[model samples]
Target: MSLPPHPSSSRRSRLDAYQSLDSRSPTTTPTLSPPLQPFAKRVDSFTSSSSLLSLDSPYLGANRPLSFGEQKLTSSKFTLPHNHMLYLTPDFKEDDDELHMPEPKGQRLGIERDGDFASWRGFVNLGALTLVIVAWIALFAGYPIIYHFTSHRWTNLGAFNLGGTNGTGQVPIMPFHFAVIDPDTPPSAYSKPSWNDPSTSMELVFSDEFNVDGRTFYPGDDPYWEAVDLHYWETNNLEWYDPAAITTQAGNLVITLEAKETHGLDYQGGMMSTWNKFCFTGGYVEANVSLPGLNNVAGLWPAIWTMGNLGRAGYGASLEGMWPYSYDACDVGTVANQSVNGVPVAATINGDAGNGGVLSYLPGQKLSRCTCQNANDDPSKGLLVHPGPKHGDGTFVGRSAPEIDMFEAQVGGGDVPTGEVSQSAQWAPFNAGYIWQNTSTNEVIANPSISVQNTYIGGITQQATSVVTNTDQNCYEGVLGCYSIYGFEYVPGFDNAYITWVSNNQISWTLNGAGLAADAAVEISARPVSQEPMYIIMNLGMSHNFGPVDLPEIPFPVHLKVDYIRVYQRADQKNVGCNPEGFPTIDYINQYAEAYNNPNLTTWVGDYQQTFPGNSFLGQC
Candidate 1:
């Protein structure tokens, strides 16, 4: 800015200054300056030293020869060592163009982009897999409700069946029907004895009083049963329950099947009653009776049966005290042949339904009919299938032609029911009883206890009073059997027998039989004057010692059918009498074995011998 100086002088001074500056710089010579190049020229820059250095970071000129300018600066002219000169050179250039390294050209860039894309795809695929797994779980775990909402209102895919009561028709309940009641002779001309009557107590007992408007007894009607003392709680109390099927008549009061019999032995278990708890009474009574229908097989034992209530006696004649056993002719004790000597009454009716003998009796048989023609269905007998043959007429009959036979009887009809097998040992599943059916005869009988409460007079509750109403009307057979309890073996007659009760104080009985004397009267009175108020009693017995002593045969699956029994008496009245001696206990039994089985699993231990070691032989009683 002062004045224009001479170029030569200024240049010389600048040159000297440049020389001095170069000495201060550690690697570069100040005399050199950057050179300009065309854009196309830069394309071949790989030939440059900078390019070589960038290609490999280790290209730090460590082994490269030193630059001429650096050599000159380090050593005089050319005397410097090569390594020393190279070491003095700078590691790299700081040019703007050099600082920015260009990526490889062409295919290399494409390859790098492809690698990035592959990695992104892997991440995306993993995310999709996680989403799919979550979706699958949500769908599978909630299928129950989803299926129900889309299908049936009430699902049965997962259901339980119990007693045909699941509201679903998946369970099977055997269909056995009963109709008509009559009392006549041997319903099966194939059997013994002529006329018969219902073997059970008169339905009149269910009413406030007997029929015939409380009919007076015949002159020789001295049926007397003494009162006895039956200890309860102190001993094993026999539980008597009211039937769950039938209800008491309107006029009926609450007949106590209750465990409250007031009398000692006379009326033991609460107010017990065979009528209130009996399931069936086997065998025939001595009377020709007729039911509402005709042509019906006339079978009689007594209308006291319990598919359920096997032991329930009314206070008036509580069987509770006599529970565990009784000297009833059917159960144990010896007695008059005509005496009603059985336990509650056990019987079965099989052979008659074309299931007679052992052949047709086998399960899965095609078709079999009753031994009687009209036993299955009859217009005259109105399906004479229940009660008994019309009122004790030896004309009642059960007929059927069998395709086969359970035993070798019906094949020839040569009196087969009484073969040696008839007397052979028979046994129930649960060690209940053993029954032997007369394959040839129509007798389904057993050796029952001889005496119940030891009758003081000849007249007692036996064939004379009532006959089994459900077995063939002419109850040539004398018992009914059924045993289907939880955890207990399902015996032969248990499922097939038609046993039920419907009453607070009464037990009515009905079986598969078509003949029973409807309304046939059979009365059970302790005496003209009983304790008045007593408990009910009931049991299932397979034997009754009362019968023609000559006929000692028994039957198989013999059964007693019952519907419902009723008990009626003055509401406020109570049995007032000292009970008799202790009621029969199992200890009272004196037999080698019961003829048939009691499905109810009570009293009988099947083999009287079994009791011998534990109870009988020891005389535990």
Candidate 2:
């Protein structure tokens, strides 16, 4: 077989072509190369020549050293297929055999070079798509963490599922010793019928042990608690709420109600609040309290409750909630059933009977004052409607009633029995009916038996003497007195499910912190109007329902003492906290408290009107 064309010969042929273009050659008729053989035969001939040329070929390096390109082509490691010709002549015609180049050895671009190059692009596209999808999922799942560091507001979406002292994602604090259900434990351990802690969750968020003795609550004396100076008119209590009446002693908060007249009221009492300071949506809340007097303490009323942050305590109905009701909804019923103007008021706003209508004009109806529309004297014009003011994340912080009465221990008034306390929640339902009055005749029509003022849509009383008793005298006042842990756990976002209140009314109690059986006292559902962020309020007042004060039985200078107050909120719920839009920041709240504490700065630092600008206090116009 002939050897492949030498490098010198190929270069010499190219030179000869150039010489022929300049010099004359005999113009002889070209002989057609003996009737050209088939193209495959030519390829076979070329392959034979290439196969003969090897690394030890005498033709190689016989003349001179090979150039870099020529050496690479002649290397023993590089070989071309004997049947496939990668190189084609200028006039090459189509042939039966396909042309192929040498495949790469080993890995190329991180993939096996098995000659399937086209598939690499498909694999790369699929890999890129997978990475993008995973990136999006991580971003969405970690949003709360990112928001915490970047944003200035607080959110209830809670931090990441971090390890905490009390189960998962909960801060360690003094756990309520009376809890009957351990959320962290399995349900099968309990013998009685069980439900989740109220709404299946609990995490400690706020706590105040009143650890500092002789601590006086005067405006800014305490960071979390403050005293209110006002005559509370919502319940028409005879006593004026005085800030000077609140103090702490022996690790307990004390509120004294005395006969000394103040602020035009014949009597004076004490009120403490956590307004505009800290608030939460829903969770377990509890406090250890000692009542001022026995259950039959004629007019004395002591309460531990919560109210939405959109209302200030001292302000009248304009800035304060209507107590126990959220945003208003008016329902339509027959005149005989609703008793309004001798005619059925049309349900024009919210649609039909079940859904409440907007607070608009209602002829001779007294409902405008009954609902949140009481903020405006003439709500018929529809000037201000909730969800009223836009705040954090542009969500409306409503100026509506969202109250949860944990316990109001009283007697000789309302439906409460002597020695028993009441636990309840309240809200304005869409089906709430209204009373109407005649324009000229001045006659009112309604069911005399059903008064909305004293009615409790959702309520329950403490267990009877068999379950709880105060005979141990383990409390203040020394005479048949006792201390009891009273509290309730609230869960929002349920449809028509009444709230559950938890109480361990034992005067001298045990931890019995396990599962509890389902019973009437704890299972009574109340109106669910407490969906917003509510602050804490503890006060002592005189109730009109109990008639005149029994001065002899519960005389002047009565005391309502509290051992501690703590709050546990749902870890997975949404909440608004310090520095949220339209709300004061923790630093600002502290700054105000500092100024209030300064005796030289006589002017009140928390003048709601001046301190909070650009909108009305609690969004009340």
Best by lDDT: 2
Local accuracy of candidate 1 as per-residue lDDT tens digits, 196-302:
22232222112111111211111111011111122332223332222221122321111222223343321211111311111112221111111111112121111
TM-score of 2: 0.46
Candidate 1 stretches greater than 4 Å from native: 1-24, 27-141, 144-437, 440-621
lDDT of 2 by residue, 505-569 (tens): 32221111111111122111222335556778899888674345676677678888888776665
Best by TM-score: 2
| lDDT, model 1, position 137 | 79
Candidate 2 yields a Cα-based lDDT of: 0.46
Q: What would the TM-scores of all predictions be?
A: 0.18, 0.46
| Candidate 2: residue pairs that collide | 156-575, 180-514, 350-357, 458-526
